[model samples]
Target: MQALKEAQKTVVSNAPSAIFPANLDVEYVISFRYANGGQPAQTGDSSTPEEQLEKLLHTLDLAGLRTVVRDGGDGTLLIFTRIRSEKKLLGEIYRSRVRDWLHGIRPAAPEKETQQSIEKEPLTDGERLRLVYSLITLPNSEGGAGITPKQGEWNLVQSIFALHDHDFNKKWLKDWSTKWLIGPEDLKVIRDRFGEKIAFYFAFIQWYFIALTVPAAIGLFAYLFLPAYSSFFAICNCLWSVLFVEYWKRQEIDLAVQWGVRHCSTVQRKRAEFQFDAEATDPVTGEKIRYFPAYRRLMRQLIQVPFALVAATCLAAIIAGVFSIEIFLVEVYNGPLKMILKFLPTVLLSVFIPIVSTILTNFATRLTEFENYENQDSYEAALTQKIFILNFITGYFPLFLTAFVYVPFGEILVPYLDVLNVTVQHFGHDEKYTTSDTGFQINPSRLKAQMIYFVVTAQVVGFVLETILPQVKRTVFKKAKEFDSRRKGIDTQTVLDPPEEKKFLERVRHESELEVYDVTVDLREMCMQVSIFKRWEV
Candidate 1:
């Protein structure tokens, strides 16, 4: 905002003849630009923050950046372009919109003499129970799970939502609640069902298995040192890793069933983002989820292959370039401080690795952003995978080169650089392939590269990732902000009566301050958190 304000003077004096500027701060401008960079094909797919943001931006108003509308000669007219007229006014504005949305409040119709009529009907016990059930599901589903199952499927549904005493979280409004690993009644139920011995043992084993690795590490070494090549040590490590994986997998299923979350995935995958059609409440959940997956979600998924490919290629290139430079410096360059210079190659590679990794990461991030998946978990997971790829490349590639290329093949391959001359005796001049004078050597020095890359480079990477990068980003952002465009506008148009308009305006405000789109994006996010299935087997 400060920069935008400051830049306005420049816009007028330096570039005002061609510019007009109005509104919002720098980060919002950058966010707006990237968010609204281009129109998605009416659909977007990605499982990353950036992509979700892009989709949301497009779904709403993408062009809300304040602009200096250059409308005339030396215009410099600070004509504000409303990228999103309602977005900026958050807090009360957002709440008001959601309230209106909930109430089915909209632009008022022609005012007529208002009349109220009340009808009295006696309520039966069955009706009362139904109403009670509906109330329980309020703020979400109501009587969806109340009825006895006419079909076998409802039995499973009954079991899923079977009333178990949840360890109440003050945060939970209804069913979408965060829960502990095990609840008290849940423990009792598991004991009754699975038997106390089996259940207790299973629970205890899970607790200790996840906990004892440190002691286990010490124990492993104690046994290993007693008799190195220790089959016992090997067995323990292998057994622990395998057991952890297998146990966790089964435990997840058990927990899912016990917690009644196993059936959570049956909900639709799409957001029903803009509900132009679905006004009716869901028959199953009884919540007013919008339904706009008019197009198949799978069709939106073809973009993943391309995204993966782009990420892989970019990572590969960075790795290749970094490895080449490291190899050349460590093996070929016999420059000053040769002993210390050996470290120079590593130092240089270490420095370049992050830069290269960052570039690939940025590319992958952009690609993911382009893909726009709805669920934050899926979106973040996809982005995390991309980061992992870049990490693998820069960190692992140098080691790969050392092991396969430099250590194993350097002796023979380096000899090819030897001087070879072809003398043109009759013609007088001769052409020669002059190899460098240094003898090709493969020594423990090759391993040094690996050690440096793994130990030193890993620490460096961790520090930068955990600490430095965030600080740097903050500092840079603080120093500079983008001008031109902001989140909203106010039309005082009184589209709704003052009361209704307040509610409507609230809906359009900043999301932080706005109403939550009560419409869940469905079970897509939850499914993503669970295991990714290759295929479903009946």
Candidate 2:
């Protein structure tokens, strides 16, 4: 028995261990691609892709980060980053905690005895990633590698992102999908796994979802019991809106505190893209901070006023013109191919709104960049506000025109829509196709039908477009790429992955290909939904 046990132990020790590939040690990934789509020049300044990559590696080394470069396929190089010293990370964590405490963002001071005491608490994935990101992106003067991807000397750098924890993501998705409701603990898990920005978005969504139940119930009751445009229901909805806004403000603060990110805005790092005109010493901290002239930023901001007006004018004109044409086709005109012509307005809206919105969004982005806010938070906030304005016009204006203008004063507006009467007649339509028909009666159900379409049908369609369509497109594209590679007789597997670390490398490569997830997009969707719900309910 003793001899058998010894042999078993020896066999167990000799056997290859299973590869878990947790990937917890990897802090960040830097993706580099050749600008000219070929091998880098042998001799050049950091202007060359190869030279820039070398400089980046040197900077990372100086900042005490471990880096391993690998072929990312498609003439790209992936730099996997890890911390060389836990002590360095611990020190950064300690300093951050201390700053938070000083700024009243954190409730308690960090351990005074030693940095190891701070390490005892252990950094969450979010914290670790954030620190590493800052370490890589902050200015060289601020003790970072100062390698901002696609910026200045690092233009060859395609993207810098942290790898997703596939295990945690799978578990999280399964847990959430299984559960009926997400509790505070679930939110905390999200905060720990992701970061405050993403966590706050989810928290807000959860809060919004719960709060909506009241309005939804009330709206159902009102729909069933009350007359159209009931004053009582309107008042109730208005009250609910006020209460929701006030409570969310309080809840937002509470969540910020709970997540230990309250007053985090105070410690926002200077944006790498921020262009500064001068430097000044902070009165309180006595630190030298880069300064951009307020007057110049103010001048740039003033441009938004005109931009908003132009955007509103353009979008409203398109919507109003489309609405008029649709009314003429459906209500007034008895033209040839009338059913097919009725869908013209829908086609025009589908084609025009997106093109116009894209242009406006791009312009808004440029305007925001020109404003040159000191930090990313402010820049994003400004851009969001601008985009929200554009969205508000495009989203709500049509509904507003239908409900307020068409429904209320359709008899008057119907005559004005006769501007298309000549055009309809010229298209070989009969005289009855014109608005001169006496039989035409304004459809009161039109507004109700439109509301239903927006509230139910539009929501479903938006979900399909936002979630399902993107996923389907990604899968199709991936399969197409694989097929193309196989047809070309290229060994995609061997080219991208080595046998020893194939699983881990494959995971990294997959994550590298994913677009950086923006919490703002989700938040914007939520905000738009709220607007739709508010209008629909009232």
**Winner by lDDT:** 2
For model 2, residues 1-538, the per-residue Cα lDDT tens digits are 1222232232212211111126624567888886332345222343666667788889998986778787776567888776565456656777788888898887878787444544455566677678778888877767778786665677778899877766777888999999778999999888777778888888787778788888778878888998888888888888888898899999999998788888888887767778889988999999988889899999989999999999999999999999988898888877577889998987898779978998999899889988999887899999999999998997789889887898789988687767777887786566755555665578888877777777777778678767787778778987887787778765545363557567777777777777677778778877887777676656
Off by over 4 Å in 2: 1-21, 35-46, 114-116, 281-286, 416-439, 472-496
Task: Tell how far residue 495 is off in model 1, in angstroms.
Answer: 30
CA shift of 166, model 2, Å: 2.1
On residues 1-538, what C-alpha lDDT tens digit does candidate 1 reach at each position? 2333553342212111111121131112111111221222111233333353333334223222333221111101112222122222222133333333344442322212111100111222222222222222212222122222111111111110111112332222243245435445645544443333334444644454354564356455755575644556555655554565577668766765653334433322331111233466779987675433535445544655675577567656656655555454455544334467456545665576667666766677655554544443455567677665555455455556666676677787654433221222233332222213455567755565455445446556666765687667755653342211222331222223245234322322222121122112112221221211101000
Q: In model 2, how many backbone clashes occur?
A: 0
Q: What does candidate 1 score on TM?
A: 0.40
What CA RMSD would you report for each candidate? Answer: 19.1, 6.5
Distance (Å) between predicted and true CA of 225, model 1? 4.9
- What TM-score do all the candidates reach, one by one? 0.40, 0.86
Candidate 2 to native Cα RMSD, angstroms: 6.5
